[model samples]
Target: MSDLHELRIERHIAAPVDVVWRAWVDHQAEWFCPRPWRASVEVSELRPGGRSVVVMHGPAGEEMRHEGVYLEVVTGERIVSTDAFTAGWRPAGPFLVRIDEFAADGAGTRYAAVARHWTAEARDQHAAMGFEAGWGAAADQLEEVVRRLVAGG
Candidate 1:
């Protein structure tokens, strides 16, 4: 563990806070990568100290889960959570994720995501795990979802 690691992705979505929040929190929506690695966010509550579970279905339809507890939650602003997947979500490692941070800019929302790791090696692992492409695709998808939803598509 190198002690510091972070991955950043930002974008401007032409939608209000409620729309953006739904795009992020909605589980039935297609929100993951690999074209078929579908994702679902099972957030029991949207507040600090709440529990969130994320499920991903692989190409083989194998399900993987990531569970965590919210450390902080500022409605329509930000969310910080610690991934406890290996213990409950599924047989996986740990991850710290901070996302949904937002700001009002013009008629839309400025959204940012920061993913942290324990060490440089872990960060490298994420990079090798398709961090850029995966996150980039997800970000794009999120923007599109919000845009379409807000536009009443």
Candidate 2:
């Protein structure tokens, strides 16, 4: 994947890995998008070849549904999914493969979300689509969710 065009958001959050992972996988709807935007998860099986469907709702009453299949999954550690194929191995227009990783960093967590594009053009398209700003904001939201999880909510 080194040669693939990539975009990523990395953070050293002041929260435990368990809390971060829980917030990301278990509490996705609460923090999957930036403020003013919301996400609805239709299917999140968290296993290899499982379904991963999420519909993002924009503040302007727009909805963008992302449907994909999980390529690999390692609970509390890594998740790799791609929209190139949906559940049941049906092909679709490919864009990028999303990889999410979490690791313990002392008492905190090291988190990274990466998007590997099929081509430079696709990568540029995603960049132009506000990937950095949008993803960064979502990461901030994830931290907020982590806070709630840590506080036993």
Candidate 3:
């Protein structure tokens, strides 16, 4: 294992853990990216060792496809995914591992996302790419989707 770098962001969503998790798993396309960028899930398996693929389409029609595997999954609690290995644990160019966690917070849910990189340089590059603002905006979009789902919209 080499030295790792991390970037984390936390938010309070006005919905229950189950609701938030549902939005995360079911409505990902609606909030996976910030405004002017859209995401579509080509494949999503909510289980350990399963494959997950998401394509983000930019405003100018550029597409970024993320292919990864789920390392761990705890229904309604946590999800860990990594690009270090693809489905079936095949080795790939290491990038980052992401952990998405949801916990009960009073009448709402406390949501957090942690992205661990293989090097400090990668972490700094992500920061320079506006990771905080981009991820924060995505979080806000996620909350909106969750709220709508919880409200039966």
Candidate 4:
């Protein structure tokens, strides 16, 4: 795919990698979507070829379900998931592969998300669908969740 088929967003979270990772995997429902849109994970298996299903509920009670499989999972470091395939290597309609990385940065963690689309047109469509604003807002919410968790909330 071309470079235009990828979208990336990074954030410096004021928490450790473990803290951030926990928020990502354990507390995803708390911060997965931007405000006014809640996310619920119907299934989550943090291992290669594992299945994951998440539903995002909008303010107006609209729901969008995303189903995918984990391509790679590394504790406290990285997670790669894709909608291009499901568990057991079953082929599915192509959407995007998302890579989430976390690492130590100063006393905090540096987190990044890279979303790769199958086609540049899809990437552009995602961007037009608020990829930057929506994802960026979700990341900010994630940082808040991690910070609160680390603070013993």
Stretches off by above 4 angstroms in model 1 are 1-3, 84-93
Candidate 1 has its poorest 10 consecutive residues by lDDT at: 84-93
In angstroms, the error of model 2 at 125 is: 1.0
lDDT of each: 0.72, 0.91, 0.92, 0.91
RMSD to the true structure for each prediction, in A, is 3.4, 1.3, 2.0, 1.4
Clash counts per candidate, in order, are 1, 0, 0, 0
The residue-by-residue lDDT of candidate 4 on 72-146, one tens digit each, is 999999999998877677889988999999999998999999899988889999999999999999999999888
Instruction: Please estimate how well model 4 matches the true structure, expressed as its whole-model Cα lDDT.
Output: 0.91
Candidate 1 clashes: the total is 1
Stretches > 4 Å off in candidate 3: 1-4
Error of 4 at 57 (Å): 0.8
lDDT of 3: 0.92
Worst 10 residues of 3 by lDDT: 1-10
Per-residue C-alpha lDDT of model 1 across residues 63-147, encoded as one tens digit per residue: 9876777777877788777774422435345765655587787898888877888677777888899888888788788887887
TM-score for all predictions?
Answer: 0.82, 0.95, 0.95, 0.95
Residue 127's lDDT within candidate 4 is 90
